[model samples]
Target: IAEFNSSRKLIPASNTKLISTGLAIRGLGPSFRFSTRLGYSGYISNGTLHGDLYIIGGGDPTIASGDRMTVKTDSLFAKWTRALRVAGIRKIHGHVIGDGRFFDGPIENDTWSYNDLGTDYGTGGNGLCFNRNIQTFSVSPTTVEGKVNAEVTYPATPWIEFRNCAVTARPGTGDNLYQFNTDLAPVAELRGSLAIDKGQKKESFSNKFGALTCAWEFAKYLEKLGINVTESPADIDPYDNIRYTEAWGKDSTRTGFRYGNMAESPENLTLVYETKSPSLKEIAKVTNSRSDNFYAETLIRMLAKKRTGSANYDSCKVVIIREMDSLGVDMSYGAQIKDGSGLSRHDYIAPEFFCRYLKAMSASPVFKQWLYTVGIAGEGTMAARLQGQSESLKHRIKMKSGSMNGVLCYSGYVMPSPGKPEDDMIIFSIMTNNCPEGGSKVRSFIDGLLMRIAK
Candidate 1:
């Protein structure tokens, strides 16, 4: 309210999640849930499925998160195995296919930097997102100085290979490891140093080829349960990679099978296993509170699929812009929305635009659900922020904070103080971009600003 640059286009950082999450709750409906269907496209005559086992993707990002963003591998997959057994399917003579057609976009957004592609924050959104597109590496220092070795990856798969070039530094040196790889590239390079720890250290890295990697792991799981997958992931993934990459101009090579197309019919094939993700409410909670880039990107694409029948990035942007227009928000406030995560430097939005969206959302039926997704005064990214506040103020301030390089942003709802009318709560957005002093300084400035506003 004082000395503000509300209309300046600036990088929103992760605060953009607020917009994507807000719009998603209204556009997709709070009750909407992402569903993944499992069906076998084959005949089972003598306890053996003669045709392919199909795993169709429904743009569900929580398949790997299990329930509520925690990994629940056994129960869900066990249901599939049990269903297969009950259906009299013991042996599968064909390939285990992953159908990712629900989403038809490039694995990596064009606006995302090449440097951000393969890290935990950079994992591309997929029609079939498993384990949140992440793989954890357990690392320890070797006897030799300046060298560290990595053990096995969790939910291990034969699809990805790692090249360890990490160095071990003296204690208190801290972690300096870096990963390099293309979104769907088969190999990843690990570089940098970590402070030597007597105890093994664990780090989670992202994979661009998560859908296929997850399918390969599922195939191995089926193999353990007496089912054989005759076809290798090399064959299936290349076919899929080709299909997804063609739109991005990364590959033009023709492939045999169209993995995105629906399998023949459910009558001929048995429904082996089906999984439904947490509702949109929970997903948006994780997106805004945790600042989950993958989920944010996935939600936008899902909206695009709902409106345009295609999950590409362009469609998503168009759909989002159109929705804002319908809501009477100025499109010029955020002239362009390149990616859902706000990871792209090309992304630009004015703080006024975010506040307008938040204000508009507050009037909607789903406003409570949307508000619940943001971090409260002392949770998630808001931890240690707005500390020592009055009890009433603590519960009333809900915000989503975003910081990337020189950009720091916060946007959401701040409820009314005691003695104030309930409707007096404010919707606000503050973004500081290109701050030479970095995130901590900008956040300190924001805290001071909030205190002044509160008084």
Candidate 2:
């Protein structure tokens, strides 16, 4: 008897994916798939894929680098390029065509607050997104000609630009930045240099930087690796292939490719490689565990299309609402969901209502097994905190933890005692909204509460 609702309505954080995912499982079923295909608009001669190489996206958000699906390495086109070159088709006089017509409406969420746009959380929903709209930059400090030299993950070409204002001063505290005046685009434009004091240790920072800007990068990576290309690609009408299909995780067991053989060397030919990402379960686990903003948002939008039978979010929201209604959960109260991962401070949800959803999840058999993995004590969001605590508690805690600036939330199942499993079964959702003490305090409090409950 936690009296969960008394804690207040909090921003859902990544817990929102739970709702989106549950709704997806119900509306789209467990076997659903978001697929991307390679289609030819031109003809082939001598086995050369002689046409505009079209990268047709079925709105699969799990494509390209940093997807962390264990198999979602950013070398699909590169591998395919090598495969094509081996198969003998070269000299493509066309542009790398990436098609993103699967979903409709503007890719970016218009309602997202202005403050979020520049960050990784505010990525665009484009027709073609590679690696969830991010690029990793590895920064290391070195001295160059008495000036400090820093190695950044710059584009392979001289096209993409960075301006760092780092100076070779005594190794100490200095902020290093490649401040671009404008947004990241596919086009290459290196603006300014760094301004960093040289004495500091070679600290590294990795960010999910850029928009859906890596499509060309992927394409370029493939082409430079000698993948045979036909011609310039033309966008296909998504309306032509819009259909309710089973969802597919990157590791579709039906496909026979192993998980880790994705690395490839790219050449100037055209090729197509199928990269396997981790299962949806793994993705969800990591998303919830890390409160990963980028992955959660991607999966949510993709889930919207999967559940609603529509690619647009407006209609997708309707589908989600209807699905939730089927479970006797009403959203009229403090449940306000503006985007997928509830990272938005605007997202609101009643802890009691969330608990109700958690209860319903417990009632489902298909989602039950996967359910525990996403929860606490299952090597997920709460694994570290719940370690050694679950054994003494005996209830087998499974939970999802969420937090933003001033909000913290948890929703999942717990057993009061091990010997009395049936009687011990309990579902709880706790949320702290606008806590004057901030999110860390609320989270620490939750940890304390869990430990107390365990004992």
Candidate 3:
């Protein structure tokens, strides 16, 4: 209904997920599902496996994710344990391996800010993501002044060492704690302070060692079940070829096994069990509704892998451009798509492109499924937006919100009326970058604009 600086390139923040998600639906189809397999090499005899048990990651992002749409971690692990029991294997003479070489790239985008790299939302995508690639810790103030205590509380990070340096602040000061750690580092330093009266608070930090963490957690779980694991948990490392070859061997058994990339399993690997993720439709819903960076980044890489046989951020950019071109959506107007989740400040897209993309998706074969991925006025990120408005108005506004630092953006379709046809929907995008105002004020302005559009 209105437009200003529509062609100007601006940071879209999490709105970038819409582009990745749309391409995923168009390229991979809504029914597509990611798979993770449980298998073993060598032989099993007398209720013992002589070789390593493998959790081959198929780039399934939802495994052990704490989202409402996914299965619980313990429940999923139990199924794998049952599969081992059913196979009459009670002892493993080798290490539990997590093969996460499905996607070949750096976990975190280089363009992402260093500060964001340590936060939970900044967790990078990986072949075998567990617990959303985050580790949580409970922080509380101690009786001693200026003293505090912190402890790891989830998914068991026995490999990680915590160096708590946080102090206790005055009452009503709230939480100001921050976690700092290098990529794949075993030592993490907790800095900042917590309020004395704040009681206990849970803080989540990024986990760069997702694949190794996955292996370690599963090994612990197996040990709990009386399964003897003689060796430690290991993840496939590109530089550590000696260890890789030693684990699987270099004989005729290594026919289909390729170093560095394990997308294709070894020929002699016996399939114990397989875990299938929720369908792409369900995943996309969670991606946009929660603005999940992990899901979006993983989806884009999966698309790239499916199209060009390479799963990396560079290939993802190529696939996105090609797919957008196929849809006749012009992105040549100063648009830079650095990462799928828009965590990078370098990502820029004209608001006009979003409107065009949304319009094109409205006519797509999977339009109905794609529509379900965005946030409605009273749901997800839009829960508090346009509050106290009529239900009709609230339901008609279906869009995704993106906010970080000084950027806030919204883009989606606004229904013309209740139960109206897709053709009648109004596609819109409002992007605000480098605004000095607080998020609430910017959100209020955008909500007012949307309410007017709904009316």
Model 3 lDDT tens row, 237-275: 654331222222123122112243343363457898988
Clashes of each: 1, 47, 0
The C-alpha local distance difference test score for the whole of candidate 1 amounts to 0.74
> What's the TM-score of each model vs. the native?
0.88, 0.72, 0.91
Tell me the whole-model lDDT of each prediction, alpha carbons only. Answer: 0.74, 0.52, 0.82
In terms of lDDT, which candidate is strongest?
A: 3
Task: Return the TM-score for candidate 1, rounded to 2 decimals.
Answer: 0.88
In model 3, where do residues sit more than 4 Å from their true spots?
Answer: 143-147, 171-173, 240-268, 419-422
Candidate 3 C-alpha RMSD relative to the actual structure:
5.4
Candidate 3 weakest ten by summed lDDT: 249-258
Clashing pairs in 1: 64-131
Error of 1 at 168 (Å): 3.2
Clashes of 1: 1
Which scores better on TM-score, 1 or 2? 1
The order by descending lDDT is 3, 1, 2
lDDT for position 25 in model 2:
54
Candidate 2, lDDT over the whole model: 0.52
lDDT of 1 by residue, 37-100 (tens): 7777658888888877767778888876754554377677787778788888888776666666
